[model samples]
Target: MLCRILFAVAISLQRVEAVDPLVDVSYTRYQGTSLLNGITQWLGIRYAASPVGALRFQAPQDPPSDSSIQLANEHGLLCLATGASPMDNTTSEDCLFLDVYAPTNATSKSKLPVYFFIQGGAFNANSNANYNGSGLIKASGMNIVVVNFNYRVGPYGFLASKEVLAGGSVNNGLKDQRKALEWMQKYISRFGGDPQHVTMGGDSAGAASIALHLTAYGGRDDGLFHATAAESQSFASMLNVEESQYQYNNLVIRTGCIDEEDTLACLRSLNVTFLQKNNFNTPSPGAQVAPIAMYNPVIDNDLIQDYTYRAFEQGKFLHLPAIFGDDTNEGTIFTPKNTSTIGQSDTFLQSQFPALTFEHLRTINSLYPVAEQYPNSGKFWRQVSNAYGEQRYICPGIFISNAHARDSVSCNWNYHWNVIDPVSAAAGYGVSHTVETSAIWGPENVNGGAPASYSTTNSATVPVAQAYWTSFIRSFNPNTHRLPGTPEWGAWTLDGYQRLLFQTNATAMETVPDDQKKRCAYLSSIGVAIKQ
Candidate 1:
């Protein structure tokens, strides 16, 4: 889910003597620069060929090599996003690019660990530009390389139908990520990154994408990543290829492709402007500010063989040591206020989970009573938040963590993020979605993230969270005493599961059990297992 009201800040570029950074992939040379804080950033590196023209709606293909030194010094053009405002207007179909941030002091022999992050936008919004891994490079104490990149999104990324399936390429966006990983495996050594030590991390849709990769091909070892970290990971029920045919046909109708001799060809031929303008990103009244994910990765036969929940139950995922968690009130922002009464909430629930039957809706309503049941507002918003948080973010976290813990993997830990920005607290959003996103990026660039008061909580959390993350990146487990006041992060266990509680307040190192165990169980029983 995208966070609200993030004013983008500009980073002033500094010119230093060309450290003469270079990467030669099959004779194609990329000359980058050591620009910020001694971290050599190689930007706009192509991981795959442009997914345009005949390549539209197809899996990512190998990037053709170049002869000259291609300068990877700028951010790649963003994938065309639906509903992007006119002010921050920058997008294109030629956005299959990745950016690498490495320590200048490091060499090809350094073999430093790599942290690859995917930006979150509910799979329809956001780009790699939202996150600059420069901060994370410094936060890792010059020991790790950070990578962020753009992937296809929305209709271009994921729009399913018989035509889409028959085209022999579905979930192209996921494939784009896979291909990027493969590229890093073959080429990151030139950039001082360890391919075998790559740790994948992200928030929201990015995290969800990681989960799909974990289960891709029924746990086949692709050797793409070694460890994973996720915040507010989604367990949203995914639609099968055929199940998304209605949406696909609807998109065809909306885009004037329905009457074409070759509707798929018509879709393929449409320009970025036309396609971005015509999309499935219409916000549902149900998700409030958050999107309902009309376009997302589906259970395509290749990448995703079966339901993710069923896959997890059957141990059909690459079991790795992971750190995953959710915020305290993850659902508040997604829970719309217009849903007040039980009937209205039921209506909203039906819209959000269209597959749910009336009985399922009734069960959900019973599980989450109206706000009258709470102390303050006599509306169902907070109740809705509680239910949605447990169902989507919190419970899926528990389920996935438990799945990892049950395996022989060591130090699979979970955490609860309760640290709300003072601005967000005053506005009643609580520690909402993507609150830790900036913190995960680390404390190098400071603006718009810290609270006004700048309490001890603020001072400690910034680096403390960084320590937990960097430790995990350096080593699979986050158990660290590097940062002052940071707690001993314990692993999730079948005997006694525990999660670290992260708060802006002091001594918040408290280990707690799953917060909403019963509610999560109820959700699982009702088959509200994953979000599409």
Candidate 2:
């Protein structure tokens, strides 16, 4: 009788567990929770093995196969970041996880287009834990699936040295991202996503990553993605792996591993806390106003064979349908506030790229002359801001758009997001970098509300912006499913260089400004010397 009772209890447990949404990717089974908003999310699924112990600083390896029913409920610990302070408990080195959001009714047969987004934090710190695809899914009429994942950042992700090159990978962070994309291509069909129709999207550093991937392996198409969306794409100085030896040496000295003969092995053997304590000791890119990123991607030749500008110029990047654009005042948030003279501004540029020669500085100053005509509180702030914005973010975007246009393989849509938030305007950041992020992802979803004004007076802009984004994910063209009555986004061309200006109540197509065009041309000519 006792044996019979135990069997009966086991049967009851099985019946109760059967009601939740489940997906089987052959090697593993995931039980997902259904949210009240008709969205089902399978969160915190490991795509790669923990990059700890012998795996530290190495290319990502596939996770071990498992058959158990894993609960995909909460997110995993964020990857340890450099200089992210008061260091929180919710961070770890074993953080190679991803999340998937889709309509509740989606099945293996749904085959919805997928949007795989890479979060931006200047390559030093940041993760995709806070992003929610519910609003984006709803905006797409529940016709798509979205994926976000974490990649190793800072030293763990980007440490480069001769010792490292011999034993481990040079660009582990980027390798982690590529691993996640490969995971999607293999397993996304189980989540009702089309492996063949994936769209890769990102902002800032994330966008910059997509740019690198486009040119990775000398433009070798990896069959990972079909389209691209790069908002505020950055083209910073990318030193070859050898040039980044100073960063590696500084880290070794700080961590007390300088005496170790096998520095890479010594680093892998050290405790994570000991290593993290010294991560911030490395040289930082940018100035007082820029994000404090101590490390950046190095040109590894294996992955990044040449500078991005040369890749595009030689037509060595994958030609794909893409959309590239930036916010109006991208540099306001990244430029120094007290640069009162042209010399100080040159110093700021040198801080970002120490390799900038005196000739380059002279040319840069000549191109960006003192425009006292512009409104600003600082003596040379606006001029410096314009120079930083164009050289770093804006011009790179335009160059890539033009490169795509030269290919003429597929349509490339470009936009200038000039919509101002009252809060940002008051803070002296007029339509600054990442201001349109809330417009793309719903206002309420990002970090609980940085641009909460979108839900208030600027509410009308949300649907229009999301419509263009989601429409591009669903179809290659943004105009395909763009909201009715909104100005049609035109494909950028070498001749016209037309782009849609996204302003509240006055959205329209405009030609690339002559001032910006001339500046970008000069910057593009010196792309090699700047190591862009």
Highest lDDT scorer: 2
Residue-by-residue lDDT tens digits, candidate 1, 1-532: 0000110100111222323487787847787887757888888888999888999888898888678889877778888675664234467787898988888877776777789887777777763354667777777677788888899888778878889888748888888888889989998877877797888998888888888889999889979998899988876657788877876777788889889988898888886566666664543333332246677788877779877677776788987768889888888777775556776665555556666677777777787765423333437777777787777778778778888877765658888887757776666667888677767675434335544433444656766788788877876667542476566777787666678887764524444444367677667666534243
Best by TM-score: 2
Error of 1 at 490 (Å): 0.9
TM-score of each: 0.89, 0.92
- Which tens-of-lDDT digit does each residue in 1-532 have in candidate 2? 3223322332232111112378876668888889989889998989999999999989999898897999999887788888865257888899998999988877776778899999887888764355888889999888889999899988889888888898988899999999999999999977878787788999998999999999999999989998899999988778888887878888787778879888877888998877777767444444333334557888988899999999998899888878999988888777777778888788777777666778988888888887543335567776777788888889999999999889874468899999978987776667888778788988876767457678878888999999999988887678767899998898898999899999887889999989889988988888888788
Tell me the lDDT of candidate 2: 0.82
Error of 1 at 247 (Å): 1.6
Q: What lDDT is reached at residue 105 by model 1?
A: 72
Determine which window of 10 residues in candidate 2 has minimal summed lDDT: 10-19
For model 1, which pairs clash?
43-72, 235-530, 235-531, 236-530, 236-531, 237-530, 237-531
